[model samples]
Target chain A: MRNILILLSFMFILLSCSKEEKEDLPKDPIILPPYNPTYVDLNDRLPSYLPRMDIPADNKTTIEGIELGRALFYEPLLSGDGTQSCGSCHNQSYGFTDNGKKFSTGIDQVEGNRNSMQIINAGLRTSFFWDGRAATLEDQAFGPVTNPIEMHEKWPRAVAKINDISTYREMGYKAFGVVQLDSVLISKAIAQFERSIISGNSKYDRWKKGEYQMTPQEDYGRKLFNKDRDEIRDSLGNVIQVIPGADCFHCHGDLSDFTDNLFHNNGMDEIFTDPGREKVTGNAYDRGKFKVPTLRNIEHTAPYMHDGRFKTLDEVIDHYSDGLVHSATIDPLMKNVDIGGVRLSLSEKAALKAFLLTLSDPDFLDNPDYSEPPPL
Target chain B: MNMNTVSKITAILMLVTSLALTSCSKEEEMGCWPPLDVPGDSANVIMIFNATTNGQPLELLKNFKDPLGRTMQVELLKFYVSNVFVSFNGASTLLKKAALVILVDPNVTDTTKKHNEIALKIPYGNYDRITFSVGLDVVQNAGDPTKYPSAHPLSINQNTYWDAWGKYKFFMIEGKGDWDGDGTLTNIYGYHTGFDECYRSISFEKMLTLDATNSNETLNVNFEVNDVFFGKDTLDMKLHPSWHGDINTIETAFIISDNFQEGLRLN
Candidate 1:
């Protein structure tokens, strides 16, 4: 009887202590090993001429985060039907674009209107999309996944799906120090991976670095590309000698990214088919204007322009040569719009094409790091 | 006293002494200009640069008749302001430590946009005159913009630099005009001025007061677009459609620069 009483007293004291400890426990316990991420230095990856990337403080690049993001980017589990991923549209082999396709087919087998933009040096751009709607890479990544026409998956559903997987939960913990995966963390990881996609090595880049020599034709083409429109006029204001100039340096300046990163009509339309930037700013002056893309991998990113109207590079050059259609919002920099276009001769056209091909970065397309990762 | 109690009292006294010493040092450092005291010697001033046409705030892309009565619409008008100096009692002081370039973009319809506003904090006094350069200094003009931060005004991403010419465009004015007044702006004209020779320094003579009584004050300066096109020298848009900082348009760019310098007035 004495032993039983002693045991009961001990059990009662233990239960009381357990209750007190449970009440003392913190509502949200502090995660151990704190939230320290290994930051990446882009100077080693990017060329010297390219400007420093403006990375967000909140979403600094980390090796762990990039690894998680690369896996997520290739995982078809992000899509509603589990048949598509970001890599489905942005294939590394095709310069991060749909190979030869004008528009990427979504998970619903529906074709998107705008072309899948090549992701080369995308971290340097101020805006995303053809219309410049999304302001940052994070904001851009938040799109597509929930876009009904693209991934066709709701944010809640996507988060639930990701959380269901143990590998992703582990990745989430490693990347963000959080076990509960959400859209914000996912977008940040994807943005870090996208920022890691730096492409500067090209034939032209090699030539600029004195590692490769340009052919005579390519050199002549480069000169024409930089030359200002000079019409040796007679006393009667008529052309006497044609000092042929393609004059492409203004909008597509050759300083760094080969893009001015500004919106332009480019005299491609006479009517409003898709009011590109006007939809965003709601200004009449912005009507028919579209964001100028980088010409880094112009050779691989076929079916060019916002709508991918031109099927070939020759067709694109031809459109700029004589097929300019004027609108009210035509960029004043399009100096040759009144004369149809720049009016490039056959030899000039071929040479310009050759020069554009030099912009193709073979190493970028074959970069194993950018390729889809194996199963997690 | 017991050792434990004595140790606790000693620790408390040490903490108090350290805090007292820290406060004493801070108070001594702040004796000349106390932290609690309101800074009556300095005042904040806002310099507003506005783009106007004939005393009216210019709305971008809106059709307006120039002094020549040519129907024109300005698509873009951006310029850089640097080397600001203020003179008080025959003594001049440079406002900025370095060549701080402020790109004034007057493209917004909203007149209160901060793009064209320059805020300064200076000594509270009556200033006789204010002088400022309308373009970048020689060193800043030649400096590689890629070295600057992305958000910096002199960043390469601003798309104002002329890489081929190896100089920045100090003044960029792009527009279209209907010379015949047929309601169609068919003619395009871009008069971009750059290079060291075209930089203009303008002076405003006025009794500008930045007294303690008026800490937050605003000074409005207007850039007359009509005067720029037809003020000093008439720019024939038909003859010279564009002046893109090339060797062929250097003379015309200089004339345009002079016209721009002549277009400023107290609004």
Candidate 2:
């Protein structure tokens, strides 16, 4: 009996010590260092490097949400006819832009009023749409899906279709903790995927990061592009200070994206037919004015202007250089100044074009992450 | 069983007693404070804008008060006042909580149908002082349109203004007035406005005390439009000149700053 009691006590001590040891064990184990490249490998590359996306506190990004958004972006179920998707107009090969079309084709072969704006680096834009109708990318996503001529589907119907899909239903639940979906969640998901489509690995970015060097002509063009335009007064009567001389930055400022978020009547046309901004505002001074387009991937987003009138960069530069027409609502900066229009020399224009080309990131266009997903 | 065992047991008992005593004392200390619940009998004040002349409600377009106090027919009365601060029992607590502020247009079809109402949900408490601005602050007026739902409609109003257009209309008053040349067919504008520099701040602190039980109560504050043109600075409704913004005439500014406040009568 004594030996048996001693044996039992020994067994209890051993068991308790082992249990405590197990409880105290570290959770994570050290592993070998991950393979990192010293230089960016042109071949077999990873995803594009995106700048920090400014997400609202209300909307947070998740992998599952982005995945669901990607599916919705490519899925034709979002359209009434089940034929058109966001990817239809935003083809990846053409830098997520419908090539050189005067206007993008929507559902039932219906055409939109303006050309499809390129989605390259669209995440960096402060506002969306040529008229600056939508304030955020999420709001922009809500536009085409509900437009009668575009997707031709109500938000509820589109969300119902997404909810019907088992994969999306699961994804929705995982991301937002609810299988039921709404326009807010739908827009949030699409915005997440769009925010992930950042295009920062361009030649210009590489040069800026000291990874690559710009050619002499390209360097000259960069100087002219960044050249401060003459000081111009905004529609609000505040004097806008610009550097260099052309004051292009007055509308397109120096930032990650070049738009200043200001509406202007840039003297695009003499006639006041469209009355672009005046349609929104009953004010007489806003007639024929429109928001300025960003110049990040301006080389790819051709057929420029609110109406998509100009086809080539040369034509666009020429218009800015000489084709400025005067009007009652013309921007005061363009009034009575010989240099109101762009007056770049031939070499300067060529250099500018070269510099603009540097804005194009081959890595962004070829990013597999932004491409179609593998066969599900 | 042994001396050491007795000492160990006594020490353990004392430790347990000390822990219990400490916990009880801590609980007593925590329990000594009372919970803060704002009383519900706080007066719910609603400002009612009414057109009146000499303490009598004026008709829509007739019997309006002129600069000379003569009974003259007038058309429009619009002006903007900004930087409003409300005080509770003469104490400054207007900005303490997020107050629900709305612009209720009595002339709007739906608003008029709904008794010409805009409601802001304020915390339940005693407030003797109610202050508000006629115009928006520069930050509120110039914030990102997507941030605020109230500002969204005006920013994206297809028939009004675009999101990029950084101007907000505080008050728009339009009607036909007697012209210098011809007759009553002429359009006179009494656009009272506040934007940027034209922002005016109005504050009112009343000595009245309110007692609110556990139920909701309302205080109806009335504004006389005729009294807005009274005092040393008078507004000529027939001439209906533009005041505030770019066309800030001295008479308009004085009318906006002084006479408008004189018309406020809180009941």
Which numbered prediction scores highest in DockQ against the true structure? 1
Q: What would the per-residue lDDT of candidate 1 be over residues B1-267, giving only the tens digit for each residue?
A: 999999999999999999988755432333211112223477666677787776667877777887767788888888877766779877876564223222333223334436666666667778988888877889778867676666455677667777666688888888788877777888877777889888899888867777767778777878788777676887766666777766765777888889989988864
Fnat of each prediction, in sequence: 0.40, 0.00
Sliding window of 10 residues with minimal summed lDDT for model 2 chain A: A37-46
Best by TM-score: 1
Off by over 4 Å in 2: A1-53, A228-246, A333-340, B1-267
The 10-residue segment with the lowest total lDDT in model 1 chain B: B29-38
Q: Estimate, for each residue in A111-193, the C-alpha lDDT of model 1 and write its tens digit.
A: 88899998988888888998899989999998999888899987766776776676776677678876556788888888889
The weakest ten consecutive residues by lDDT in model 2 chain B span: B155-164
Q: After superposition, how far is residue B250 of candidate 1 from its true place, in Å?
A: 1.5
For every candidate, C-alpha RMSD to the true structure in Å: 11.1, 17.1
